[model samples]
Target: MSDTTTTVDRAKRGRSGSVILTDRRCGKRVANRTKIYDRRCPGLYVSIIPAGVATLSFKFTDPGTGKQRSTTLGIFNPETFTVEHARSRVYALKALDPAALVNQLR
Candidate 1:
């Protein structure tokens, strides 16, 4: 019998599969089971409230220093004006990186 090896290209694959986003408050990765929603809105929206209204932020992990830091991306109105709606809006914002999406809208 001849030995044969198969090669797999990881980058070509759709996603990292096991990759995760951690929640700063809970100190746990945000699970895929979380809910998301889409809503119609008018005018410009911003996510300036860091603690409230589900502001967009980025978490940076430093390997050498073993430290993690978070930076605010921007402020968005979300337009729902409700807690439940805000949560869903935040989830979509996080996943889609609204900065790019918002720019494309204009």
Candidate 2:
């Protein structure tokens, strides 16, 4: 038998560190934007689109299928979102049951 496993970033694997404003801004300006997960909060990340639009997102694993799942929290822009707000959102989302979340997807 063969085994296959997909691992996310080390920081995302567990509580690693907190995300700062500079990190988020840099991600938005990068040519090839990728997900920048908050080390202090598991499953919380910022996704910067090609046009420099940054969005707050949450990632979690579904217990039933053992697969990763994600959802958008809000937009991370100067007039709208902030790191504190994002952290609070993450706290709220973390309290939800994974199974319930999966069912909602269906």
Candidate 3:
């Protein structure tokens, strides 16, 4: 997704890298105008939405087309979810058989 934040700053600070995100780091990045990808999680990202509500999302290569795509996993709810929980979801998604995932959806 695009944002009003300049590319220069993002590039200098890095739009993506190796730093692990803590709860506070997640909060800070969530406020940024661009989606903040977690270096530790290949397909996981925090979408740049309104402050106080960070949306956890995942990106994957579409098997059929071999193209990258993204989808929302859920929003961060401290009482119900946290960074570790979200990362676990990403791992779960990665571990699931694609066909099984589709069947579950049905």
lDDT of 2: 0.69
After superposition, which runs of candidate 3 have C-alpha atoms over 4 Å from their true positions?
Answer: 1-18, 29-32, 101-106
Clashing pairs in 3: none
Off by over 4 Å in 2: 1-28, 103-106
Q: Summing lDDT over every window of 10 consecutive residues in candidate 2, give the lowest-scoring window.
A: 12-21
lDDT of 1 by residue, 1-106 (tens): 9999999997555333322222332222333322111222211122222234434333434334566544444433335243334345445545554455444223
- What does the lDDT come to for candidate 1? 0.36
Best by TM-score: 3
- The digit string of per-residue lDDT tens for model 2 on 1-106 reads 9999987777444322445534445344645556666777777778776787778877888789898888787887665677668878778766768676766545
- For residues 5-101, could you state the per-residue lDDT of candidate 3 as single tens digits? 6455647674655457556765654445556778888888876555656788788875655777777787776677677898998898788887564
TM-score of each: 0.24, 0.64, 0.69
Model 2 RMSD in angstroms: 8.7
Mark the regions of model 1 whose C-alpha exceeds 4 Å error after superposition: 1-52, 78-106
Provide the overall lDDT of each model, using Cα atoms, as 2-decimal numbers.
Answer: 0.36, 0.69, 0.70
Poorest 10 consecutive residues by lDDT, candidate 3: 97-106
Sort the predicted structures by TM-score, highest score first.
3, 2, 1
Question: What shift in Å separates residue 42 of candidate 2 from its native position after superposition?
Answer: 1.3
